[model samples]
Target: MSVPTPRSPAAAPAPTSAAHRTLWRWHFYAGLFVMPFLIVLAITGTIYCFQPQIEPLLYPGLLRVTPQGEPLSPQTLLERARAAAPAGAVATTYTMRNDPRASAEFIFRLPSGNSESLYLDPYSGAVLGSLSVEDRFMKQVRLLHRALLVGKPGELLMELAGCWTLVMIATGLAMWWPRLRESGVRAFAMRPASGRRGRWKEIHLMLGASLAIGALAFVLSGLPWTAFWGKQFKAITTAANLGRPGDAGAGHTHAPVREGNHAAHGDHRRHGGTMESLPLSEVPWATGLTAVPVGTSASAGHAPIGLDRVVAIAGSRGAGAGCQVALPGTPDAVYSVSCFPSDPKAERTLHIDPHSGNIVRDIRYDDYGPVAKAVSYGTSLHMGRYFGLANQIACAAISLGLMALAITGFVMWIKRKPANALGAPSRPSSPPPMRAWIAGLAVLGAIFPLMGVTMLLVWLIDRLVDRAAGVPSRPVRQ
Candidate 1:
């Protein structure tokens, strides 16, 4: 819904100026562009927030198991899962749940380059079911939330939308600040007798102001997942030893000693690749750049330590149940075990030498750099995993609040717009002060290059349209 305008009583003390008009115009444009995508993100994100509760109901037989005395060894369960899977499906990772009733899950990569998860009864060694990795309902929702399920192009589009949403929030605050100044608490008051548009405006302003901080957190936390800005940000932060822990910054207890050809780089080489290169499922953001250490083949001629030994090794190193172990794929591959707990402080990752069943490298939450630590907690809070159900409710409320803002905004626009023309706010006689414009451009360019480029392009197009229409241009004042 529209913010309190210059003529509105809530903003009566403030005279309409170039800055006010300019901000309103930008607020309108940003909202218009971001509304649809915001709605989609809110819906999918809300649904995904409750995935822990929903998925169990959707796949009770596969996810849940009755603990019958001592459970089968991990190696036995892996073998049973492999036998039940499609022929030639190689087991890549095994996830051990802390809950006694939870079934063992094994991720398998089929010969056709597709991945699936097979759930087995931990006690009986019986296969319960299998699900296509990409086709799962929650996975599809996540895809839509991140990329609109259209892949890389959609990912880029969503990133742009997210960047513009920050602009929308900034301009919206500028538009609403006058009302807050003039009316104090009364500025947020709803006027039921003031008609439908007034009601929508009240709801929109109230929710928008209330949820702005949370919305910012969501956008900023989710930005780390974007295809373009995310990679650049990761690289930049990693290089600065702020986002991801480097060799000296990691503070890992046991750094793996490289042997053979890997010795040139010494212990814990920075491979400049993400954890995705390893067979990991749900990795922590802080360790995303932590390189996978290659194993020495000195003991490779001996029987390779089996999955059971790897699990025991991880447990001995404090990575107990709930850790997902990525089985070594080659002679030089080390078994990667990740314990991604709901509590960010307990997050840990370990690499075990498959040949000697020795801990190669061990990284805990403490090993992360300051920025990386902040991001780890931010991501957990963003996903509503930090404080349990209450956190979920809070996150869901914010998502629903965003949806309400979008819907109310649409209603306000529909009622205010003329049938014959675009309903955008009219431009001011003069642009915003030159210094303000320059400062804004600098901030956007430095923080969000994509938005800065597009913003300049939009400004150029507006200037061309003004020139074409013969509108006299007034110089921006200080």
Candidate 2:
């Protein structure tokens, strides 16, 4: 069989307006560039949203245990956990729950350069088995969601894609704007047609519009973690008069303590029937104090509080579900108990003196600043736990819609061919102005730092390519 010749350039049609052509060209190319990233994000996000339900099923043994005898003391559990680890490694124990049937977990770094986790019978202190962090389904899904199975660069790329997704949503809305007035319900509603092209277009427009808000929410919430948005958020929060002045050297600052009897003190020394407070700096051991262990304190010479006592104290103190009891790390360390009472709410961080088992400080959710509260809620929203079943269902719906949007977009792009090169018209054109294109690009770039940088890079590359192709440079309209 004879090989067919390629179509001649002369047979192609010319673009209506150079600017309209450029906008469409960029849209097509950018969509192509970000498609893989988009797919990864959608898949990972879908998996991550179901983690609360899926994780327990995947690691049932890791999450629970059968009652044996009286629960082991937190101190005893710590020692047992430490003994299980290799030399020089520190053990972190979580004091799980009061149900003798409930399991407690100890996490520690092994000499083999891997972290090891073990589930134990809280009552008998019997080690259940070692767990591999890598073997955890949720961990793997989270990694894929945040980093695309790669490291920092992948994370950055994902963030960039997230930013671009916002852009895509906006552009898509602009493209869909006409339908708002003309078609009403049919435009906003899903109405699949018989033709392949019609179905693809319908899918693209309807799904994109439906998920636009959700996609924007995810992007805006996630931006706080990106370098650019982190700084921007800091500035915005500062300017909004939300929190106290942040320390120049510190990423955060504590609200100044009120000048009443509740001021923070350094040491717990006994004075005239009261505690003799020292400057935080004057307390030599305070400098080394990090997270207090669940039931031990520095005042007690950093002796480990027995696991049983810690459990008793936590129960007595009404430590709610999802509470974590962290062990004191150093000589002056206090055991810290952190708990979240509800979804989309802040946590309570409580420090207790190990020796006396007295509560040192209690920081409730309401005590946190607005930004801190926002951060907590944003995290909950990201995890799809902000509102309960309704929120989770909404997230799942959005993820499915996003997947549909992306697939349909790709199909639509594939279905349409570029205009012919020799000034033929596929159809008569009503092209948008160059100024409109510039405004759209500027708005998109302003909202997404990565898009701004990418736009600059694209312009530079286009300049170089045109120069090499002996084509004259087109002046950007003022």
lDDT of each: 0.79, 0.59
lDDT of 1 at 275: 66
Clashes of each: 1, 23
In angstroms, how far off is 362's CA in candidate 2? 3.8
TM agreement with the true structure for every prediction: 0.89, 0.74
Clashing pairs in 1: 1-409
Top model number, lDDT: 1
Cα error of candidate 2 at position 114, Å: 2.8
Model 1 lDDT at residue 261: 32
Q: Model 2 off-target regions past 4 Å?
A: 1-26, 67-70, 86-88, 98-101, 190-196, 231-319, 340-342, 352-361, 417-447, 462-478
Query: Which candidate tops TM-score?
Result: 1
lDDT of 2 by residue, 113-180 (tens): 56667677677777777776565666677678777667878777877777777656665676566777
